[model samples]
Target: MSRYREFKMPDVGEGLTEAEILKWYVQPGDTVTDGQVVCEVETAKAAVELPIPYDGVVHELRFEEGTTVDVGTSIITVDVAPGSEPEEPAAPVAAAAPVDAPAEEKKPEGRQPVLVGYGVAESSTKRRPRKGTSVPEQPQAAPAGTYSAPPTAAAVQGELNGHAGTVTLDRPLAKPPVRKLAKDLGVDLTTVTPTGPDGIITREDVHAAVAPAPAAVLPEPAAEAPAPVAAGERETRIPVKGVRKAIAAAMVGSAFTAPHVTEFITLDVTRTMKLVEELKADKELAGLRVNPLLLVAKALLVAIKRNPEVNAAWDEANQEIVLKHYVNLGIAAATPRGLIVPNIKDAHDKTLPELAAALGELVSTAREGRTTPAAMQGGTVTITNVGVFGVDTGTPILNPGESAILAVGAIKLQPWVHKGKVKPRQVTTLALSFDHRLVDGELGSKVLADVAAILENPKRLITWA
Candidate 1:
């Protein structure tokens, strides 16, 4: 006899409640080994791959791809004894049982599944009741090819709406992506009939609801009939989930919780720009990212060293100021998904060449959307290079729990007084925003001034350090 093991969704991010199944690498009957990655999931922080801890044959996928599964729910099942004769496939109709079946009922006696990083919690095997319903009775599997899937929540509710005398309070049943599409299309899913298995509303249903009906008949065309205009979609709605959702929540918390104070300064960076060119030519720094941001980041590190007080965070629970001896410097990079700030750990201790290498790796990783949550956490300060977007500058919000964020504007050639004469100089604006409660005006000013001085004269990096 073959024993089956269930693999539950683990909490990949810090206290995240749920994650969307992005893709599955293995399927039913596929042989898997210990520590083999079975699927990839996207949490609010980043995309992560889940590895099966022990070897077995994949038995079943509990949920479809793009389904947002709550943490701790079983996602896949594996049969440990693969050499045994393959059992008959379970009927798809039976698989339609309300996913809220009791955890004890689903698991075989005394079998525990463990995931990496997230150890098994006692409640890990239990399934919480779905919103607005008690535990439902298990439906019997229909004879082969004789039964249809259960009605979707929408269809059941629709029948209630049309014929039932009593009102149903249960919310409509749809996947997160389907709900987002319904929201984007300004359609009430409850009013639309469902055609999907299990009566679930799908993306096509939402789009169908949005489409306008055509005229029954057309009038005779005139000699000069205007060309039919191409219909364009009025708006695009992106679901606020995954990394984008995390960024939204963190930014809102930082903005409202912290008393932000912003300071701005314009300075000449002719020397810094020239140093970028020099570094590019240096064989030691070959194949490394050599840019003005490199010098700016180095300058910021030096400033933090000089004005250490500006590098501290406000501890709300204890009402104390916690000063950091190490800096996890966050570099804000705009990716295809959204803006992600992945940082270099202990950046204050890295040399210029090391910093360049870290920055290059960070950019490449973030661009590929492979940045891990560990790379994004524990930052002391952040740098947002709005300069890449060709904008002069704007005040940037502080990353939550951090004291300060520095914004670097576009470095443009502007006429300035140099050597007692007017000349075109490499000019840029710097905006520094800090948690006012933690960083006072004098401390913030000194840090910004130090960074500006280094950029204005690149040699200050060596002397100041």
Candidate 2:
């Protein structure tokens, strides 16, 4: 008797309710083993590959590629045992599955549920690590048409035990994540000499050739003139999808719905800067990135604690305000693709060193555009560090559901009071914008003042909080 089992998308990470199917490694009729890479899923935080949990022949695909299915949705159905009747030849194996099944197909409108693990549940609210972060080492090349075998015209099955075979390439093309990595490392993937099968450039090839020949410097013009604009200059338009889509929707939602009010306060932060330097030299904090942002993050956390109203959400449909005790601290980051804020869960519980490490990873991940959609969710409050751009301050928009967002300006040398006398000191401005519907003037002022007070005197944070 033929037995079958369905493989639903598992909750890949902590409380991850759903994920978008990026691509599939196997297709209908292909035999997949336990722990084999089966599909790539883009969670809210990063795009992660899910390995098959059982050995079986792929029977049917539940959802097509690019479809954002809820967690526990049956993505694929497998036949664990060979059936009495011979199975028909399956469709071509594509890197991506069709997002929406055709109307003619005899399938449920929603995806099927996988048999094992937590059944996919309905999730509400649509839409949507850096420094020393080691990129995973790429495996050796695999041949085409064979999951695990040497390159040949005839297709072979499982020739290399469990390995996906050497990929044959007409020309080298890199994935988006790989391309981003190359750009960050200052290496052009096209220029790097490829060693993979059929002249494919792998990560190893990129790491091997560390220093490439520098670009030729153009000679300085004897007399400079304004650069002439080309006639009918070409323009390129890239379609916005995935995180970009969710971001656009959220921005429109917040901008149109929320009544925003911004407040600014400037204070001398010499002590906070001094603390950062001291922490950098401390033995316990060694190997951690000690930056001014760390103190600012901690200050923000403290302010949220004192003024919980600022760490709240206005539930229009529910006709109430939801206050969150735990803080999911969002850090606004700019990447090659667009802006993303991946919050640190339970941020208020972390120590300074722990917070530093989290911020470092968050910034790096966002810049790499690897932040999954899940990390950008459930943020109670946020901090935007405009300091990196050398700007003093600006009114930052509230991150969709969050009640408030704090902006930290650039730290610079300025004249200030010392022992009741004027002197030079390090100072910075803080701008806070809140949803006036949820946060009153007194409450907003207190939150911003609390953060500014911490920066003015780091010792106050230790004593008060």
> What TM-score would every model get versus the actual structure?
0.67, 0.58
lDDT tens per residue, model 2, 84-158: 453332222212112243544322122222224211121111000124543233333322211221222121122
Q: Taking the tens digit of each residue's C-alpha lDDT, what string does model 1 give over 1-465? A: 124667778776757899989889998999988557788788877776677755678889999988999987889888765666544432222112344446543432222223222222211012245567665443333222121233334433433443323323233445533443455457887898877754456667777888732111111112234455568856555567766788899899999999999999999999999989999999999999999999999999999999998889999999999999999999998765578787899999999999999999989777766676667878889999999999999989999989999999999999999999999999999999999998989999999999999999989888989
- lDDT scores for all predictions? 0.74, 0.68
- Model 1 scores a C-alpha lDDT of 0.74
Kindly report the root-mean-square deviation of model 1 from the true structure over all alpha carbons: 18.9
Model 1 lDDT-worst window of ten: 213-222
Runs with alpha carbons beyond 4 Å of true place in candidate 1: 29-31, 81-232
**TM-score top scorer:** 1
